[model samples]
Target chain A: MQWLNLLNANFRKEYIEMKRYLPNTLALLLTFYIIFLAAFFGIMFVGDPASFEANVQYSIVSVAFWSLTLMTMNFIGFSVVTEAMRGTLEQLYMSPMGVWKIMLTRIVGQFSLQLVMMVILLFAAMLTSGQWLSLNPMTTIPILTLTMISIVGVSFMIAGLAIIVKQIQAFLQIFQFVLMALVFIPLSVAPFLAFAPFVKGVDMVRMVMMENLTLSAIPLADFGFLLINSMIYFILGLFVFHRCEKLAMKKGLLGQY
Target chain B: MEKIIEVRGINKQYVKRKTKEVITAVNDVSFDVHRGEVLGLLGPNGAGKTSTIKMICGLLQADAGSIHINGLDIKKKRLKALKHISAVLEGNRNLYWRLTVRENLEYFAGNRGLSRKDVKEQVEKLLKQFRLKEKENELVNGLSRGMQQKLAIAVALLANTEVILLDEPTLGLDVEISYELREILKMIVKEEKRTIIISSHDMPVVQELCDRTIIINKGTVVVDEKVENLLKLFETRAYSIKLGGTLSVAQEQQLLVKFPLCTYEGSSHETVVNINLEKSEDIYDLFDIFKAEGTVVESIDRTTIDFEQVFMEIVKGEKAYAMA
Candidate 1:
């Protein structure tokens, strides 16, 4: 009950925090419209018989999907580190909650708020692309699930790096500059042929997207390397967070700027 | 008196690996805070007051020391001890900045395990008490510093811990806000009868709220006494002297040797001296030395004392362990 209570409080805080960005909601909507136009009209004007909206197997959807997911992940992770720098971290640390409870609460809170964005994007894309609604639910479900888990891993990594990095402003700037550019890599690779371009990273995303990823697409080497990587990365993030929490407390910056 | 919190020989040593020099932040500090009393943990900047408070709250782990809170060992029973304490830390940075005052209150109250119904009622009560009823719906980030501070204290109160450790609660707050906070704290003390340990440099707050004070300097306590007692102790030291004439060189030397700290009130045509008596009979020595100078003492008047002067005197005069 107490843990649930904590989760509720965190959820409330997160909701209220995000609500102040209500003005930006219009901007987010406009961006979604632009992406839809780019997918439908841009490709049409280019005279490609490929109707991106009509095709369930379209690469454009995957690009837009991953971009939105990674953006949400980045927002949540950066917010935590920013709060740490601004000194709200100490108040959370001293509350009547366990360390794990505190971290889980924040993560869940961020996840819940970010779900709204995910929902909005999903509906906008699905509503515009109405013909491709009910194709391959079984295959799509696993890929979607794995992507969320991997996004969580990426979120954890960003949070961990935020804690370890010196000069928070500089770190965040550098991180955004690199990661925003990196989001297009998945975009660029999704449109390419499997064996033609033969890039290293896309093969990995495709490998995990397969039904028999661990057994067929790849050997059982590294004990299910993708699964292992996600798990290991999340654990290491938790470890770094715990250490940074203690360090800030000792330095008396738990409530300091 | 019942001991609500006992800190025994707490030691903290911070080692900077690059320089390899160990800076002792807290050294063998031990004290007891009685139930239902305000114990001011007074110290100058860098005097380890913050370190000691954080350790008691279980936000920090002391390198070596045992802290028992309400008879539960802090290190061994960390959660239990921490549950007994809540701190309104410095700068009012505790509350979630984007949450409204009401939301922040409800959030913390819920986190502390108050039921949903109680949280609603209690939050309303707190908003009224803190005078933030109108601003309850406003985001904390948009509020003024005073309002945010009041909200932070309101949040701390939501936890309803037995002991409230306030680390510089009045720091950076305007006079009126500080007064309001102090007033609210006083009410909480009386109504809840909660034991409070306030670490502050605000002497007036110390005088108004704290019954006793433990003054620390350079990671060690210099004085631990009742606030009233400290004021009274230094109240006797303030004196104004009436003189007959100026002093000879030998007489001035004798007077300095006897009093060690005398001010020549040249405009008033008197020599005022304040001395901590080594012995009660030291007055006879004072009389004889000044008498030899033919600087006739017309009258000696004791000045009324205040807490500020007492603080200065106590901090200025370090004890020499005379018995040793």
Candidate 2:
């Protein structure tokens, strides 16, 4: 029940802030839309005509995943930096539910909101390019949910660093491209990247959307691998975050910017 | 009185980034705050007041020693221990400026795991209590600094914690608002009976609101005594004497040698000397200097000392005040 309250409070805060900062939020969506347009035009003008349909479908899914992963993974880090700058980081630390729980609830809240934005962008991209890939919510959601756990874990790691450093904007600016590579690069091209956070889930979701596969149609081992990969990153991310929190406290960096 | 917060010999040190020189921010400091007591943690800048407050809030870790809140060790059971305490740290914008006054209150309460339904009545009470009802829907950024501060404090109160640490609650307010905040705090102290630890340089706030004060200097506890007792201690030793005539050079030299901290001010007809004596007999020594000049003593009055004067004498003297 307490967790529910925490979740509700954070979700409401995220929603209110998004509504209040409507212009900035819309600009962010437009930025993603432009990125998608760039991908669409690049494929149309530069790619082979033989695989034009397949290529456009692939770019649309990749662009949507890229925006989703980039926002989800970087949200907590940016949140921490903003809180520290706004001088509320220490106030958040006063929560008896623990800062990690607050951060987790906030990530969940942000993920939900960003998911809405991602859908809008996905549709916009499809509408502009006149290509629609199968958005198998049933198969894609469960996989995407599993993928998000790993993303949440990695978000904690970034938030931990932000707690100590307090100036990670430059780092985050460069991280969007890293997320883009991770989202667009196929598992077949780099099989070893499966061990990385969210790669397996993204690959699975992409395959499900592009190939129109059901949950049961995918091999059970693939699900098991994705689940284990997420759990490990989730746990590791939490461990790193806790360590960083301790370091921040020890160094008296939690309130510094 | 039951002890609600116990801090034992906590130490905090920071190294300068440029020079890598280790500076002790708090060294071997210890104090206990009793239930329903108001404590003024007073100190000059660089005197470790902030480091001490942060340690108690569990926002900063100590290099040595331990702190327990309601019998839970902060180091080992931090989140559990935090259940008993909340703080509005100095120089920190403790509220969301983008959020409305009501939203900030409800959100902070919610952050502490309390449902909006649970805090609705209390939120209404605090808004009215802080006289912020008219501006409840306004964003915090639009409110005056005093209102923002009041909202920050109201947010802390909504947590329903047994202990609240307010660092410089009246730091930047105008005189009217500062007085208003002091009055609100006094009412809270009288009515709520919650343990409060306020660290501030605002002497009037400390003098009026605090039951006792602990003065820290150079990273160590210099004086720990009750507010009235401190005022009385300094009050008894302070004296203002009016002399009938000017003193000779020899008598002036004797006065300076005997009481270095004493001040002498004079016009053509009269000389006035304000001095704080270390012992009762020191007054006799003062009179002898007057006698040497054959100066008639017109009047002698024991000066009433406020908390600000007492604080200055203590901090400027840099000596541990022995409380009897």
**Highest-DockQ candidate:** 2
Off by over 4 Å in 1: A25-57, A126-131, A135-150, A166-236, A247-257, B13-22, B71-77, B113-115, B243-254, B266-276, B287-299, B317-324
**Runs in model 2 lying further than 4 Å from the true structure:** B243-273, B281-297, B318-320
Task: Please state the interface RMSD for every predicted structure, separated by commas.
Answer: 2.1, 0.4
* DockQ for the candidates, in order: 0.40, 0.86
True contacts kept of each: 0.52, 0.86
| Per-model TM against the reference | 0.79, 0.95
The weakest ten consecutive residues by lDDT in model 2 chain B span: B315-324
DockQ of 1: 0.40
Q: Per-residue lDDT for B1-324 in model 2, tens only?
A: 999999999999999999999999999998899999999999999899999999999999999999999999999999999999999988739999999999999899888999999999999999999999999999999999999999999998999999999999999899999999999999999999999999999999999999999999999998889999999888888899999978778988888898988988998899899998989999898888888768999999999978888898899984348854
Query: Candidate 1, residues B1-324: lDDT per residue as tens digits?
Result: 899999999998877769989898899999999988889998778889988998898777788889999999987777777788888877667877767778778877766655557677778888898899999888888998888888888888778788888889889988988898889888887787888899888888899989999988789887888988877666655566667766667977877776776656543355555555545577688778877756778788777767766666666664232110
Across A195-242, the per-residue lDDT of candidate 2 in tens digits comes to 988999988888888899999999999989989999998999999999
- Candidate 2, A93: how far from true, in Å? 0.6
Number of the predicted model whose TM-score against the real structure is largest: 2
Residue-by-residue lDDT tens digits, candidate 1, A105-154: 76667665655665566556656656333323344443444445545555
Q: What Cα-based lDDT does every candidate model obtain?
A: 0.67, 0.92
